[model samples]
Target: MFGKTINEISLNDTAYFEKTLTQSDVFLYAGISGDNNPAHINEVYAKESIFKERVVHGLLTAGLISAVLGTQLPGPGTVYLSQDLKFLKPVRFNDTIKAEVIVVEIDYDKNRIRLNTICTNQNKEIVLTGTALVMPPRKRMDI
Candidate 1:
């Protein structure tokens, strides 16, 4: 009821959201995911590690994509089917992340859509890329 219906949505429609990750954000995500990996939570250990500093959880950044899909692109009432993600770079605390999604294909008959997803850091470096499959809202007339 919140997003564009299948008939109203078109190919190339896009949406994006940005967030600056904080140490608190990393800690909260780590606690929720139970990923107490030293590289993410312990500065000393991280400094000793190859990254030289705590690296934010990859999935934590990826979650931004889900936020875009749920609140913007296909919007509410959309059902996420599947997603394939590739991690291209590491995200550090305080990195501003931009999560974007573009509609690539729409199957009106099946009421499904395929989209390209991407997340970039402040420097416009690709941190993640992927494709998502989702069932978009049904057309009001058809329903």
Candidate 2:
């Protein structure tokens, strides 16, 4: 089914992409999203917190999934309808994180799809998991 789906549709079934989390990424995200939480930016404060180190924003990992969905898997012309996520582990700076997405369901009539999304670290520990609903480009033209 994987090979067939890949040939029939442009959407990707499963993929792995990695990025090294940096202090700059946290700071940039903070500046752009107004999420200047100490856990995300202040190493000293983070050291005293439960995590004992700076942790990236949960939304940051979630955003990575959106990137894969919009740019790689379903690619362009895909409409993001909704997403649900659960943060399982903390993501620390300098950690190499991998994000993956797989098609779970497809609604042909509405051109909608459901994908299983995941983010993990180099140790293969899952940092996040979720489901996303998107509208991929249809195979047929509508008048």
Candidate 3:
């Protein structure tokens, strides 16, 4: 039973993953989020925009953080408490974005952790930066 007990996670632990946005991803997000802003889906409209191309939704990029926290770093069964994001650059279609999470703080008593998260594109430009709070499983205590 001791071996099965939930273990604590540390800040030094890290998880890195990458994903490339496709036209389908753009379309799906546009459809689901109801954010059919021309900048995201309309080619002609996007061409005239500052980016000169269709850009992925900021929320889509931020969503990668959820993947990192729920699957890799803290593994399954982790609960996301909150996330704060800043969009620094635009993420365009066909852009391969890399998401990284570095554990920053661990609250053992509360079973919570703070992570410094960032998403960067192929150009190595940081498109998003933020902090994520997650609740990982903890060893059960019995009186």
Tens-place lDDT digits, model 2, residues 34-141: 999998888899999999999999998788888776666676556789999999999988888999988888776677778899999989999999999987655422
Residue 75 shift from truth in candidate 1, angstroms:
0.6
Top-scoring candidate (lDDT): 1
Ranked by TM-score, the better of candidates 1 and 2 is 1
Candidate 1 lDDT over residue span 1-143, tens digit each: 36667877889999998999999999999999999999999999999998999999999998999998887778887789999999998999999999999999998888899999999999999999999998876743221
Off by over 4 Å in 1: 139-143
lDDT of 3: 0.83
What TM-score would every model get versus the actual structure?
A: 0.93, 0.87, 0.88
Clashing pairs in 1: none
TM-score, prediction 2: 0.87
Q: What TM-score should be assigned to candidate 1?
A: 0.93
Q: List the residue pairs that clash in candidate 3.
A: none
lDDT of each: 0.90, 0.79, 0.83
lDDT of 3 at 27: 93
